[model samples]
Target: MSRPFLKMNGLGNDFVVVEARSAPFRPSEAEARAIADRASGVGCDQIIGIEPSDRADAFMRIWNADGGEVSACGNATRCVGWLLLEASGRPSAAIETEAGLLQVARAEDAADGAKQVTVDMGVPGLDWRDIPLAEEMDTRGVELQVGPIDDPILHTPGCVSMGNPHVVFFVPDAEAAPVREVGPMIEHHLLFPERANVGFAQIKGRDRIRLRVWERGAGLTKACGTGACAALVAAARRGLTDRKATVEMDGGELVIEWRESDGHVLMTGPVAVEFTGTLKDRAA
Candidate 1:
């Protein structure tokens, strides 16, 4: 049966959202890869499946462009949240994922009529056990380095788990950082048993940061919402920045706030609906 789908983007991180609440739809790894291929099929950073949820408004299933199923995706969450809110004409919605429950709310719309969304990413996990490193160590400063031992280019990165694992490296300049070269190395490092999302962050100010991320299974994306949240938390924990900051990414900016009182991280950004179409086959 042909199924309808929506193509959406949060910042420049795009997604192909399939609504399967009533009609069941699940794509295998190879099928997901085919659909996510830019040249062959509907191109997107991740393929999102919106399913029925007993505990929340809907369940969000995420598959990276490589067809690997992951626990969470913050940009996809915001895009799905906006769709739910617009459909229900409500102010908020709850989404269930492999990571956990996420609370999302509608913010004031932009002048261009695009709706803004804020997601409660929950508290970050700072323990090595939570991040599931191969060995135990202090998450604030993990023992890892790259480049020559005498003069390492990246070293002592902070680790955190925002649904998924993340290792943030504070750099002198984000634009100049070797993201493509070093990101894969760190992601597959022996210490990170489950692999990790790598973030290169440059503190522009107490309230601003410039960041680029190499996402696990997805390689380098235009923007990574969870990476932005992780960067702000890691920056604040290291005394490099405040609890809240505007993270400037290659695609756009995201406002991330680590709430001191509740410890939940809030991410605010805009979502855009690029177009709509129908898929003749679930795999295609």
Candidate 2:
């Protein structure tokens, strides 16, 4: 039987959302990869399953394009949050994920029919073990590099965990960074046993930063919510940028704020519906 699904995106990071509240939708790794295939299937960076949650409004399950299940996805949370709010006609909604529970609410919609969203990503993890580095080290700038022994192409990245691990490398220019070449290298670096999302961040001003990310399992993406949050935190910790900044990515931009009061990261952006369809044998 075919199951219904929705195609959604925040900035340019896309997802295929399946409703599995009543009936579970657990796909095998191969099945997930097939569904995320650009040519043959509904292409998306990740697949999200909205399951029933006793603790929150819904339980969000995330799987990258490579079919690996992960704990968090900030962009997907906004998309799911919009759906829940529309369904319940409520001012706010809470969604649960492997990473933790996220509180979401509508920000402000635009005249162009775009839905604005705000996601309370909770507190970021800064400790060595919080990011789960391979060994003990200061998270402000981990000792790792790529290139020559004396001069490296990239070095001393600030680590942060917005549910998933991310390492932000402050660069002179974001566009000049070899994202495709260096991203995989940093992601698979021995220092990160579970792998990591690699970010190339260029601080444009005290409140603006340009960033590009090579997401683990998903490779290079237009936008990464957690990566953006991590970038802001990393920048703030390094005194490069303020606690709040506009994180510009290839797809678009997001307002990321490291709230000083609660230390929770808030991601504000727009969510869009590309289309919707049915996947054959929806695992219902």
Candidate 3:
């Protein structure tokens, strides 16, 4: 039997979304890899399965391109939220992910025809135990450095967890950061027990930052929703930026705010539907 899917993107981080509420669809590791393959499959950064939820509107299951299942995905959460809002004709919606329940609402549409949406991404985890480093270390700045001991290329990365662990290194120039050289090394570094997302952020202003991320299982991507959220929280914790900032990435920009009142993070961004199709050759 054939399965239908929706191709969606937040910023430039694209996904192949499968609605599994009526029929459950749990892809195996190899199957997820095949579905996310750029050459042979639907070609997306992640594959999202939307299953029925008793706690929320829907349950989101996320798999990275490398076929590793992850707990949280901020950008994908917004896309799914938009779908629910549009379908239910409601002002807000809730989505249950492995991370937690996220609240989403409609926002003003972008001028470029891309739909804008806002997602309440829950609170960021700031403690070392929350980020869950392999050993005790300051979450504000961990003692991990790349390159030579005397003159390290990158050092003292701030860590945060949006369900999944993330490490953010502050750099002078985000574009010039050696993302390709050292990103993969940090993702599998001994410090992170569950592996981690790596981010290089350059503070542009009190309310602006430029960032690039090497996602744990997806490698370098145009944008990462939780990556942006983590970057903002880390920056605010380090006194580099305000509680709110516009995170500019390779794909586009996301507005992230760490609410002082509730400690929850809110991300506003654009969602684009590229196309829709059916999977005729699903892997068993």
Candidates by TM-score, descending order:
3, 2, 1
Per-residue lDDT for 35-83 in model 1, tens only? 8899988888999999999999999999999899999999999999999
lDDT of 3 by residue, 90-177 (tens): 9999999988899999998887877899999988998899988998988999999998999998999999999899999999999999
Candidate 2 Cα misplacement greater than 4 A, ranges: 111-113, 282-284
Output the lDDT of residue 146, model 3.
90
TM-scores vs. true structure, each candidate: 0.97, 0.98, 0.98
lDDT of 2 at 171: 97
Cα misplacement distance, residue 52 of candidate 1 (Å): 0.5
The lDDT of model 2 is: 0.94
Which ten-residue region of model 2 has the weakest summed lDDT?
275-284
Candidates 1 and 2 compared: the better one by lDDT is: 2
TM-score-best of 1 and 3: 3
Q: Please report the candidate that would top lDDT against the real structure.
A: 2
Clashes of 3: 0
Candidate 1 TM-score, true structure as reference: 0.97
